[model samples]
Target: MTTISNTERGAAKVMNRTDLTQRLVARLHKDEAVVGGIGHTNWDLWASGQRPQNFYMLGSMGLAAPIALGVAVAQPDRMVFALEGDGSLLMQVGALATIATVEPANLCVIVWDNEAFHITGGQKSLTATGADIVAMARGAGLTNSTWAADEAHFESLVDEALGGTTGPRLIAARIDMTKPAGTTDRDPVKIRLNFMSGIAPPDKEG
Candidate 1:
């Protein structure tokens, strides 16, 4: 895989988070796992569709990627996607480096960079000023990191990642600070059990 440089682009495409989430959900046919971050990220994922393969985080600043990493490592045959917000990702940026070090081939990280902690108070984040998440991921040794230029480009990246490519890819997108349309059901135990059953091998699933 090749590293995508921020300097090589004009500006990242600004897209609605829910639209992207819906597009992603529509394309999930291989039982690929999705780990949604706290707040809007997970809210939109839950809204997109309550698939058993989707894990929604309720309360956490930046555990999405870490949890997805564990799932990817544990199920090497399954593709895992982690959806995170720019602010939350900034809170635990070190996870990117750890993900790079482990290098799970089926892992894909998607960062929604609205440039603010929208859930909290709409405070500006470093990305709003000058931080480039794709660049940061690349620096952390995730060479397959790239900024989606537009919705079409984002779809292309998603297709490539889910096509069984050997990658621990990171795809960052510029999103708007709109409220998500739905809420994740608040049942942690049920979520865990359903996800476990969804990902288990056919024969292993009782």
Candidate 2:
């Protein structure tokens, strides 16, 4: 078992909050898709906005992957991106196995590995274990796994992952756990509405 402290990791994927959100939104800008997020504030920012797409999350930290698995299995045709933090992913890794078996090609696990739980006071996280994130996905029977910390690489991986045959794909986007910049917990009503929209019949948008 080996680990690399944030200090040792050096450098991080730096992008303005809005820019990051926009970039990710572009990737996941599809209706009938269920995107699972892990962080409260970050997820809230993506949710509270006019996403127009479907997104749900486990705001309490960890559990994003499992939720993503559920959505992907339920909606195998549409894509499901699990935008999660390294700390959150560490908390509930067993979901990886469930995802592996479900084999939903529409599911993509994008881990914003910042080495810490940004919402919880930016404390260190298990990602420091420097555990090969890509290997972890492979161990869980996921293909199309890679890691990126820069804009160019991330863009490429996103395209490739989405273009692939699907199933479970993982992208460990290396970033820093900076101060939280997002909204408060979401309204349960809106959450349910978004989910309903994901699976609702076409004539039921009202």
Candidate 3:
């Protein structure tokens, strides 16, 4: 009956995404870590345009999962997580099937299912119940998935999901995107160029 309540009923910690991202990134600080998503931080990282340790998502919301998959496959020793949004995941739902096949233990997919595209406007999305997320991921063949209703539970889930278990895990979180962090303005052309700099084909001419 309640929509997007901070229920805090799970064992995972509820965070404002960037905070969680900072926490997780801190955990893997020493290693080659990559956080792919669509938004301000992403655009910032993309504008910086560094490779190996930096990957900014360009077009498509759901593609971050697949992108992280490739990064995990190509660089098996690195740490990769997808800071995905619920709206974006709705765009590329099928890519999840590939995730199950790849099964990169180091891969962690965190969906900040705020029920809207924060970067755009806090408009309504398909995640009216937050049901669209957890249900879809479970059905996509991914195991070790959980949803966090509060901050404490989210932290715990992160620990369990990333502790030592084999992954392809999804953490669906419902949040309120009202606390403005920043804008979603980025140099798209520059992002494309920077992105290409990192993963250019061997035979491709620049």
Q: What local lDDT does model 2 show for residue 70?
A: 75
Top lDDT model: 1
lDDT of 2 by residue, 36-125 (tens): 465643553454465545555646566767776776676676676777777677777777777888787777887776666666677777
lDDT of 3 at 175: 61
Error of 3 at 154 (Å): 2.2
**Cα deviation in Å at residue 138, candidate 1?**
0.6
The superposed Cα distance between candidate 1 and the true structure at residue 25, in angstroms, equals 0.9
Candidate 1 C-alpha lDDT tens digits along 150-182: 888888789889985767999898998889989
Off by over 4 Å in 1: 1-10
Q: What TM-score, computed on C-alpha atoms, does each candidate reach?
A: 0.94, 0.79, 0.73
TM-score of 3: 0.73
Q: Record all residue pairs in model 2 with backbone atoms less than 3 Å apart, i.e. clashing.
A: 3-129, 105-167
List per-prediction Cα lDDT, in the order shown: 0.89, 0.62, 0.64
Give the residue spans of candidate 3 off by over 4 A.
Answer: 1-15, 40-52, 183-206
lDDT of 3 by residue, 81-145 (tens): 77777888888888777787778887878787777776776777887644567767778888666
Clashes in predicted model 3: 10
RMSD of each: 2.6, 5.4, 6.0
Top of the candidates by TM-score: 1
